[model samples]
Target: MTLMKAVTFRDFGGPEMLQLTEVARPEPGPSDVLIRIHAAGICYHDVLSRAGKIPRDKPGQILGHEIAGEIAAVGSNVSPDRIGERVVIYQRLFCGQCPYCLAGRQDLCRNSRVLGENGGGGYAEFTCVPAQNAIQMPDGLDMTTAALAVCPIGTSVRAALGVAKIGPGDKVLVTGSGGGLGLHQIQVAKSVNAHVIAVTSSDEKVDVIKQAGADEVIISPDLKFSREVWRLTAKQGVDVVLENVVTNTFGESLRSTAQNAKVVVLGNIGTRPVEVDPGLLIVRRIRIAGSGNATYADVRRSLHLLATGAVKPFIGRVLPFPDVGQGHALMEQKAVVGRVVLSGW
Candidate 1:
């Protein structure tokens, strides 16, 4: 009956709904490992969960998906060697018996239970998870940076490599290029030797995106911006457009992509219906795809890339665990430059 401090929300609303409370520490099962959470990266999905945008089957749920910590204890059947090892957690817990899991696509498992959505999440002093979801952290990686591996880096890995199959010399345009995932997408594209054009809404993020290895950066949602993308590519447009914005930016992304190029939509920040000409898809042969959370392979590859120093994550600010509501407020206001991590639980 040991008690641990955790952030919880009973009825979904705004940041005010988030509350700090003491809860029972979870006991690890035979194949589970208990972790002392060092940091939890706040994401937009967490905001949506708090606002009731993402449905919750139960009440008083804790809401943080991206987590990084050290293994504190393990079940009797688990290996003792893992204790005290630093690790990044994979948010999605899948049923190994599902067809999707059998095909190595555990991200799409029908019965999958995401960490924050299913039960106890990372916004706690302690969390218990399956040993399979624990990924070893390389030396020199800190908790704040490790927390991003599960969401931002993992999503970029899934979209850029797993779905888009972006290759060397590929011309890629990343919309919403100033945000957490956008910056990671730029790094991932650069790692593959792709020429990256980052599109953002403010001039403030221009230099930031450029320093992250973007070949070019543009202010978004302007037809002139599309023209600039074409001009940069010698009027041929880009091979792939990472469309994370949901408003007119989506259409602009579609317009900026080269003939037969692919557009991968990952976010719904704008969250509005868009109009598209059917002829554009029919004649230009553009492909539109949706990507979600990372697979086990994606998580491993992302961590490996992070370990190799290929992807350096931009951490905006770190708030104390008790101030998770303030962190959420910063996120809602779009006040952060990169990932916002919560620490000192």
Candidate 2:
């Protein structure tokens, strides 16, 4: 039997639960491809899973969703020509029969199962994924950076383009602009010709975001941030606000958005609920949307954007697969400036 090393958690709590173990390598089904994972990107969802905040019925769970690798083998019915192709994978697997799938909203499919949560995942030497989920990585792109093409880039594509519909001359605001997702959000927003205003917690991130095409970068939650954004936009609030850290800056986001603006909430690392005043919604007629994972179409579009150099993913560091605990700790401490990538086989 072929064996591979994988990181898994027997009990959910802290990073300590992440352990390296040897497991039987999976065999691909007729429509699946076996990938030898070169790199995987760590996401907050992985931390949420380890902390049991995401909720799982099973005890042992392998965790990693943003995956990129070379095709090692193809199943019997698959085209052998695809073997050896470098690719990034879409993490969400939907049952094709679902109504959401028919509507091109596979991200919201009723029978959707996410990699690293619904079953075995990419923190391993090998993983079996549907051929449809494997997208060809552009030539010359680093595998480490391509690993991020799935989750962070794809999510930003969905939020900025699919949900918010940001376009040329649009003024966009992104909260948590120093973080992984925030950085990509800035790039995606700019790709649509929008003028991006990034909100972070520190001055160090200001330059980082500026380099990523943010027209203005503000230290978030400071009274001066809203003022700076207002001044930059000539006292008119931004057209769209991408709110990720809900607990820390939800109210600030509400204040920074213009009347009839769209605010998309993606994540809440602070773990606190956001309290909204009804008047703000009623008077401003602002739209607030909750965005989850990206659909397969969104992932495909993101890959194309990356291929064209329209979006660049900044990878902060690469950690050994077994040291996933340390990686999670780095994220918890906010020490990473961009996406933290993990390497396996």
Highest-TM-score candidate: 1
Task: Estimate, for each residue in 149-183, the C-alpha lDDT of model 2 and write its tens digit.
Answer: 87899999999999999999999999888889999
- What TM-score does candidate 2 get on C-alpha atoms? 0.95
- Model 1 steric clash pairs: none
TM-score of each: 0.96, 0.95
Q: Counting only residues 3 or more apart in sequence or on different chains, how many pairs clash (N, Cα, C under 3 Å) in candidate 1?
A: 0
User: Candidate 2 overall Cα lDDT vs. reference?
Assistant: 0.86
lDDT of 1 at 324: 92
> lDDT scores for all predictions?
0.88, 0.86
